[model samples]
Target: MGTSWSLQAVAPPAGTGGGVQAALDRVVAQMSQWQAVSDLSRFNRAPPGEWHGIPAEFAEVVAAGIDIGTASGGAFSLAMGELSEAWGFGAAGPVDTLPDFMVPSDGGIDLDRDARRIRRSKGALLDLSGIAKGYGVDLAADWLLANGVRHFLIEVGGELRGEGIRPDGHPWWVDVEVPPSWAGAGWRIALHDLSIATSGDYRRGLAVDGQHYSHSFDPRTGRPIANGVRSVTVVHRRCMMADGWATALTVLGADAAIALADEKELAACVLANGREYVSRAWREMLG
Candidate 1:
């Protein structure tokens, strides 16, 4: 997680701010791909076909990643670590040529929940950059609540989760930013015990040979998605789900993304081809 994070909670007993910062730091240390000694990095470097034990938090995130990937039909995959690095999005920076690697099948990586162990069958690279920040937000929220702060809002990067009302007795409000490429009044939503995450091409991308490559990659093509969809936002009770869904929908583009959002009954907004599409569930939430 190479992004800024903020936590706003009902004033906790004095001197508790350090505890929140420590908890967030732990999440970064455990999951950041940029950190050489992170749990995820060690797991990625581990020899294939060998069962490696991981921390409970790492296991939980990986489990959630696999579940979301399956549900999104591979639109969201943790196995794109190599692809990300090849495209210069990872710590390795950009390479002159894309790495030669076979895309991992859905079941290429196996996780044993009971044993907290994982093994990869085909040397698949694991990258959790897309969802790790959201998980961090959730972890921070839980820390605040457990430490006697019930009203709080947690945001890492652009992913956010909020619950309860502020000390002023108002629900947490967030303004969804409009993509720079689009023209419109920004949308605002009152978040109460719900989380929202947004994905956009304008945020992080690489330009090569006079063409732009987004960080969001389509697993099917093993390349950056060039879909006309510029952004996707999803709201869910859990920030992690919203984060993953936003990225998945962005890769799926507008039509398919909206269709899947409806199929899953998710509250989502997709900005594509100079148009905005809101899922039925999102409209219901707005109302």
Candidate 2:
């Protein structure tokens, strides 16, 4: 997403506070060290059948991504790495000239559940950008909690997670960025112990022959979704759930998102045709 991020924790006393900052700094550094897509990424070279000995925090994220992918009927795939690379969404440089969209064939990937290992046919790359930011947010929040900070908000890119209460005892407040359609609307949400993520075609888009191509690609078709829906925001107890659900809902469109949210009792907001459709669960939480 390349969006900015800032981490906040409950203010601590003079001498005690420094340790919390140091801990957060260390966590951020560790996250950067394990980033699979960065220039110094280590996960890319992980040997097949090897667990990579990732921190528990990172492993939980991988497991959650797999679950969300299964829930979305593969709409949220991590195995579309090659497709992303071809479209210049990978570490590779931008496609000097974008190619016309073509449906890609899926390479059947094998995930070793107990081992937490992954194997794919050659050319299969794992793309975690969609879910990793939320995972990072969760890690930041965990870091705060472990350091004795209870009331806090932590975000990576645009994903946010908050817990306990603010120093003033009010819920943490956040706003879903109303797209161009919902302009002139003031809609900040008060949240506590909830993570929220919004996926929109508005960010990181490419234009080809006057058509906007979203960064989100459908794994089944290997093409940016043509759905008219503008944005999907999912709120849940875990940042990973909110992040992955938001992406899946973007691919599924408004009605499916509403239905799924209702079935799962999830908090969701969908934007279509300049109108917003929110789930009752979300409404209840907002209230």
Candidate 3:
């Protein structure tokens, strides 16, 4: 929610740009943690023991987060709002120079999709920063398509989704940027009918007492991730899935991330310890 967005498209209907912006705005209104009155913020502040109803869009994102967290073996956790705040990356904004980090005893959120309701354990707080931007991209893309734009590439933050072809009759090709700290070459891929997301901390790494910390945190330890992984990129039909998988794989590190990516047949790339690990599906996708 602190970043920007852009769209490249063929001739679209009048006001298509404004339409896309409006769509993205809807996502922020429903999910921005920085906004104290957003649906996500309200959910984070909800009292325990009661099911709180959320907007459909917010519920959809939460459902996706739960699915990803479970599939990644807890590598991608949404119930870390408090931890994120403690790490100075949340809505609370740099709490007195990072308080003694508290690992919540109950880091669990129960979601009932049928009724679009959720309840979290006392110490658990749900945060969707990992996947919300990609959802925003998908929402904007959908809005464009519904309004008669057949070819476009939409990006929010760095996550992107593409549909059809450019006015030049070429697929939307994007060159993935390598983390500046990594020497590995990045991949350039066609984004036609697909979405791509990358997670990395080279630009956001924190240093405290001579120890470097990655912005990616491990919910299990309630601290910044110490995994050697420096970056992870994922491609999927849905930007939300791509975004969530990128975060999950980054937290899982190289070996486990590659194994899971292969098992799931996900298109993923991981950079760790000065080496690049590319999943089998990633090669096939580019080929």
Candidate 4:
């Protein structure tokens, strides 16, 4: 939510930037962990055993997160805000060690789709950093399209979506982010009605006593990832899915993630231990 965005639309309407900002403001108002008054923050601060009402958009994101978490075998979780906070990766500021006064870990979460509400069984903190930005990107793109701005590329906080070709008839071409350890030319691909999201350890991390830890936490263990995974990149029609998959695949590491990608027929690439693992679908996409 604390990032920059840009849009390149073919003959975009006037005040396109204003429309994009308004759309993103909706996402922030609903999901920003940094904003204590946000729906997500209020849900986090809520006591156990009470249903909290939220907007349809929040419900949608949560539903998708649950689906991805279940499919990833718990590699991705939405109720990990507390863990992130304990590890100094949250809005509550940094802490070197886990607090002793921690509340009972929740039994995960419950959602009432028809009611547009969610509940915490015990005490769970919900965080949507992994996927909310991509969802924001989607919302902005939808706004552009609704305003008759077709053939546009929208990027918000690194998550990206592109549709149609540029005015010059060139597709929206993007280079996959290369990890620091990678050698040789970076991979380039065209985003034609597709979105790309990347999750990585090298970009931002935590340092403790001279040992480094990835900002990405494995919710299963409530700890930062130590797996030799460097990064994961996923391309999908929905940036939300791509973002969530990138996080889940990063947690799953290269081998297992690749297997899952192939099984799910997902386009993804995992860079780990100085080696690259590309899914069969990714190879096909690149080709």
Candidate 5:
């Protein structure tokens, strides 16, 4: 939520631009951890075991997060708020002593869909930074479509979702950044009503005592990932899924990540230790 958002839409109504911006703003207002009064912040501070009512959008994102977390076998977790804060990624800033290792409580979050309520058990901290941006992009795309725009590309903080063809009849194309530590040109992919999200360790990491700590925290180790994988990019029908999967796969490193991507038939590309690994689905997509 602390990042840039852009949208390119065709034939949008006169006032539709403001609507799209407002849609993204609403998502950030509801889910941003930087804001003290945000819905997610309040829910994080809410007493455990109490059902805290949340907006429908927030509830939906939480449900998706839980689903992905379970599917990744806890590789993707929303309950790393404390770890993030300890590592100076959160509002609390850096601390002299690192917090003790703590495994995320996978099933601690309970959501009541009918009531639009969420309750956390075992003091699990909730952090939605990983997936909220992608959801915001999806919402922006929906906003454009609902406003009579048939073709659009929406990107929030690098995660993107595109639908329909460009006005010139060309598919929406995006460049996958080549890691700074890697060689060769970045790949260009055509987006045909699909979404792509990439997670990388080269950016947004901290170094302490000559050791690099990535922004991605592995829930299993309660620490930032120090794996050989440099980046993971995933393409999916929904940006939210792609966003979450990219983070999960990055945490799993190159081999396990590609394995899971194949098992799920996901289109993913992994860059690790100066080499590139492409899944079968991704190869087909490239072709």
Candidate 6:
């Protein structure tokens, strides 16, 4: 419920161009293939014990997630599958919970790069909720570009990235959704060669036993982040960075998130408690 995306490429409008239609079909098929979260979800399941091989894409994404998690101080780990599932946030978990926070600290995952294997030492699940969608968006954009489409805007599951300028010579526009009650406040970003992602607890909330739980979980604590922030949006040159930052900031809450964005010079907008705090870099990018 966070965000969904669409792609508008300057090839001929759907029915008007046969070649464009075929290319679009190819891109759609690719998106579908990579978005599945089942066993096919490369980030969901750990490698079998004694199994040392993985698909190239799986290896790549895992490596990327590990890097991001480390960089974010373990704020964006892939080892959240078990906790998410236990709380019914997984393909098998319940969506009902009154408590928003869960205890942190769980088993560890041992990743072997040379052997191309991952071992969940004590059996924790891996969930790539923060970055997978952005990865998919980037993949779609790459597919379109490689297929000879120079100008396009791709949005998938609320994350977006733009390639080239539109025929109008303006950068693509993507709106950052603020809580509806926040009057007259919106953040719209212009992008030509960047990807933007927004994460929020406004939706996908679970209510149980007089408590409400957010969908965003903290890998360190193995529970939902109690950050009262409504939304966090990040814009970056890499779709993966934008995606992960949006998630990391959402988990970090508004104040700390803004400070971190400032320290890192990441373009960001944080909405919380009926107000918005925008990073200087993000404000500059808008102009």
Best by TM-score, which number?
3
Q: How many backbone clashes can be found in candidate 6?
A: 10
Tell me the spans in candidate 3 whose CA falls farther than 4 Å from its real position: 95-98, 102-105
- Point to the candidate with the largest lDDT: 4
Candidate 6: minimum summed lDDT over ten consecutive residues — where? 26-35
Cα lDDT over the full model 6: 0.69
The TM-score that candidate 2 achieves is 0.84
Candidate 3 local lDDT, 1-287, one digit each (tens): 99999989898888988998898889989999998888888877778767998889888899999999899888888888888877777876653354575564365888999999988888888888999999999889889988889899998988999999998889999989788756767888899999999999785755667766777887777778878888899999999999999999998889999999999999999989989999999988756
By summed lDDT, the worst window of 10 consecutive residues in model 4 runs over: 97-106
Candidate 5 C-alpha lDDT tens digits along 55-74 = 99999999999888888888
Off by over 4 Å in 6: 1-5, 12-51, 97-101
What does candidate 1's lDDT look like per residue over 132-235, in tens digits?
A: 88888888888788888888888888888888989899999999977895976667878899999999999988776677778888887787889898889899
Query: Candidate 6 residues 74-186, lDDT tens each?
Result: 77777676666657766664665443546654665556888776666446555556676677676667667766878888777777888888888898977778775777567
Candidate 1 wrongly placed segments (more than 4 Å): 94-107
Consecutive 10-residue window with the lowest summed lDDT within model 2: 31-40
Query: Which sections of candidate 2 miss by over 4 Å?
Result: 1-3, 13-55, 181-186
lDDT leaderboard ranking: 4, 3, 5, 1, 2, 6
Ranking by TM-score: 3, 4, 5, 1, 2, 6
lDDT of 2 by residue, 1-287 (tens): 34466656677435444553454444344344234443214554554333344555555656777787787777887666666666776666467557665565345345566765555554455566777777767766776677677887877677899888888878899888866656546358766888999998887666767777888887778888877778898888888789988988888778877887888788898887677888989889755
Among residues 3 or more apart in sequence or in different chains, the pairs in candidate 4 whose N, CA or C atoms overlap within 3 Å are none
| Window of ten residues with lowest summed lDDT in model 1 | 98-107
